[model samples]
Target: MESAQRHLRMALDAARMMIWDSELSNGKVIDSTVKWFAAGTSLLGLPPGDLSQPFSTFLQIVCPEDRDHLLDTMQEAVDKRTGYEVEYRVQWPDCSRHWLAAKAHVFCDEHGVPVGTLGIVWDITERKENEQATARERELAAVTLRSIGEGVITTNAAGVTDYLNHVAEQLTGWTLEQARGLHISTTLKLIDDTGAPIPEHAALQCLRLKQAIGASSHNQLVTRDGRHVAVEESAAPIWSDRGELLGAVVVFRDVSHERKLSKQLSWNASHDTLTGLINRREFEVQIADALHSAKQDNHVHALLYMDLDQFKIVNDTCGHSAGDLLLQLLAKMLQTQMRDSDILARLGGDELGVLLPHCPPDQALLIADQLRQSIKNFRFVWDDHTFELGVSIGLVEINHLSKSMTELLIAADQACYLAKERGRNRVHLYQDSDLRLARRQGEMLWVSRLNEAFEHQYFRLYAQPIVGLCGHGGGHDEVLIRIQPAKGELILPGAFIPAAERYDMMTAIDRWVIRAVCRHVQSVRDSLGPQQAYVAQRQPAPAQYSVNLSGSSLSDEGLRDYIIEQFVEHDVAPEQICFEITETAVIANLIKAQDFMAGLKALGCRFSLDDFGSGLSSFAYLKALPVDYLKIDGVFIRDIANNAINRAMVKAINEVGHVMGISTVAEYVEDEPTLAVVRELGLDYAQGYAVGTLRPLSVSD
Candidate 1:
């Protein structure tokens, strides 16, 4: 018996078990009559005092959350007269809580009635803690998946859908219960940009490639309801801790808004916003295609370049808002006139282009005239004002004879210019033998030379003396621009001035003249001795330079500031310079010219209205302009001595000027007789070959 008890105790110590034995009566366990053995009492941190306690006393030590469960489990085991096991938490004497597992067996009497119970209790704190930590990790992973923005789907090794996050279910319109065990491709339907089914699912591809596979931007998702949604997706192979292939995880997001924005940007790049027509870049592309067809297939096409006449008049009379509305209206009207196959494009401000395929020059001319007449009849109304507008159309035939796209465009533009020159609201056809077009082509070549001249200092300044007729303002010279080529005679302004003005380069040229004249005057002043300079200052300034300004420059608001900067840089006096403008320039931009004149005059600079009597209403505008000089037009002055009508015009201009207290100068006095006529008219100044010929401008000797 002693040996058996010692062996049992050794077994219990090795397994860390506590044993409890309770006696029962009336087929139920009695209270406060329990036996403890093999460190049973020590397991719960209780003292051994006969080690017997009521069942209710033991229940008090059990954790409050586990007490009811433990009582119910024990009662069931006792009633069934069977064995059972349970796990519960206990609070020990030291106030520390731990997990305990109990296995109990019921001992019954011969009639199948429960009498006594024997149980073994052991601490399971560490094992229970490990299980709880693992559960927490799994729960955290699930919550993180639900919280993330990107839709996440995980598949098994066989490419079968095994798990789906909340986001994935929403995106695919499939719940986890509905998608489980289904093939990934069946759950997530993917198609290409063309709406064709992808050959293999991204998840399957990832499993085959054993690497990450990203779907193209063109990928789309087809929901169960037959709605297509743009999506960006990537699938990566999932691996286990043992480096074995588990499954693929697909992550995706919707990119519909971004793709829509991208398409809008592309549309904006090729179309004009104001007119809702294809822009110049797209028009040029159509022309290139036409040229290619003409070259390769021997096909004929026609191109029309249209320029709206009097567009500036409308834009200036009304505001730019009215101008925009007029352009929009015109674009719609022109579109209605074109055939379905013809392409119409807005080339730029007040200019448009049309490409007609399989049309000959004769047919194109009729069409161009139709368009011109339509524009001519169209009256634009803004506010309470109504204005009639016209168009100049240039038609060029594209055939095997067409050299290139650039040549075709240039030909069309030249034709359009000629149409405008010949009286607008008409169509001009391009011909190689057109002398006027040839002259225009020559002028286009001068544009390049003029740009080069500006860079290489090839331009020289020349002056023609303007003698005082009334001795009011003498020793003034009219400044002129000349170009000296590398190996030719000097080129006059008449050779390139028209091209410069047409190309919007006159403003730059005018600024250069201002700087050069200012520099020259400063150098001359520095050269003179102090006493001589003082004496010359007391007398009339050595010479006042009259620089001619174009109509474009008269409208330049920044020109005034630029001139002021030049004066400060060169230390030139304002009274030494006089700006010369034509009557046409003054009438074109009367308000800007008046403001410009007023600003400069306040600073002591002089203004001369040149080419007076050229316009029909010169006298009507004369009273409005504030000027110090009125240079009569050379047309009237060159023949004043011979033509009585010319003499009368000059006399009228001189009288109008004297009445306004403005000085008058006569141009083109080529002979002594003309000079006498100018003096006889009582002009303030006479400028011609008779007074002095063209010579390089220089400082006083």
Candidate 2:
């Protein structure tokens, strides 16, 4: 029994815990494994004491802050004869403080009744301090996320949203209280532009790839309210100290406004400001593509170069306001005149260009004339000052031969120059012939002489008698114009006409001829006393004069008013007058021609389609033209008696003309056989020398 007591004491001394025995009856310490004296006292503080004392309470060593609760719990355990555990601060006699975990239970004497309390204590201050520091770090991290300006979302290892900072809540249109514990995709919906959820948006890719990743520019974010915002996204995985994947974080920002500005700038760079049309630079870009297509597809396209005539008059007469209004109105008119497939642009001041993709030269010429005439008839009633304008058009076929943009431009410029020269308001086909080449190169020399002739009135008129092959009506005389130089013989119209037309002097020339014809005819009528009138009536119908009009005059919207003004000025009767227009001119300005013919025909005047069957598209314009005569083109009629094709073509044209109720005239009849053939074709009139010799008109014509 003594050895067992000794062994119990030794075991208590060797324990890591401080062992204590207290009397439950008085709440005083009876024994301790270590002596409570001097420097050996632990856990509870003691100032000084004996190894074995009657009264040395452990309460004195317990910190005052924790003493009451620790004592109460120990007493309760003693009363219930049960075990208890507690942690409390220990204030030692050396003025040091520490934490202790205490465990106690009531012990029974040999009679099995509670007599004392036994307990164990451990110092746990280091562990407690470490736990407090870890808690502070967590709180600091949460505050940092909340304070940051950029949005942040954190998900758990299972890809569930566990936390959201203040900024993240606003960006995602959600709150931490609402988003917590939901799947990341549900709380922070990321999508593509099409509104489909992005696979990378789940942020699991970051974990799988073990690196940061980003969304494409097309990525978007759908907010909780269901509004979609354009966004740039980036994501990275959270990690543990051991380099294990813990969760993920996503970051994003909106970019809708940025995109809009970019697109607006692009549009401004390519569009015109005044007319809202595509500017010249972009038009040339489209032209390059068109030219490339023409070459690669083995097809043809046409370019229309237009110059508005008399536009400056409106600008000079009225303020620039009227001119601007004219341009705006004409731009609208020209746009309406083209097909939907065609492209139109204001090339610059008073100039417009059209791109007719896949359109042949024939149709292009028709379109140009249509635009010309449409404007001619358009009456500008601007604030009590009505104005009319004309358009001169140049056409060129875009083909493999058009090697460069500069070449195409040069061709278009040349053609437009010719159109203006021949008479404004006509479509001049661009032909690379020797004659045209010479006209372009020889322009400077001709311009001065033509001007000098106009100034000096060095121009003369001739007449060709139209023999009535049908023998039922007296046909009129076709009047011709010639230029008489001061130093040389009379000049054929062909020599100076091309230059005159190119220089935009045709309107003046045509006006001069009309005035002269009226005066000369009036003189003849006055010369014929009543007896001479009977002699003049012996041929057939009255001698109404057939006069030629330049294409430029046709496009002059004021030409009709000007013509009426001239007739009043010259005392010429409208019934005794007929106007001749070539096939190219009529077709080039179809609408203008149609309106012009309609206007004049209403006044009992007559119109004739000159040089018919010269173009492949003569039949197309014949139905639209209100004409009284179809002068078969000199080419088909020149030698029809010898050429089978020419005879066949003339026969066909004559048939069509008769069907249309138009009389046909055969021109360039150099020999009798051609005249015989013309008569056999049931021709109404023949104007060639074979029918009658060309004569200078005298008082008796």
Highest TM-score: which candidate?
1
- Residue 555 displacement (Å), model 2: 51
For candidate 1, give the lDDT: 0.84
Q: Model 1 — TM-score against the truth? A: 0.45
What are the Cα lDDT values of the candidates? 0.84, 0.77
Query: Model 1, range 65-170, lDDT digits (tens) per residue?
Result: 8888887887788888888899988888899988899898999888887788887788898987677555444544664465499787888779999787887888
lDDT of 1 at 636: 91
Model 1: ten consecutive residues of lowest lDDT: 135-144
**lDDT of model number 2:** 0.77
What number of backbone clashes does candidate 2 have, counting pairs of residues 3 or more apart or in separate chains? 13
Candidate 2 minimal-lDDT segment of 10 residues: 31-40
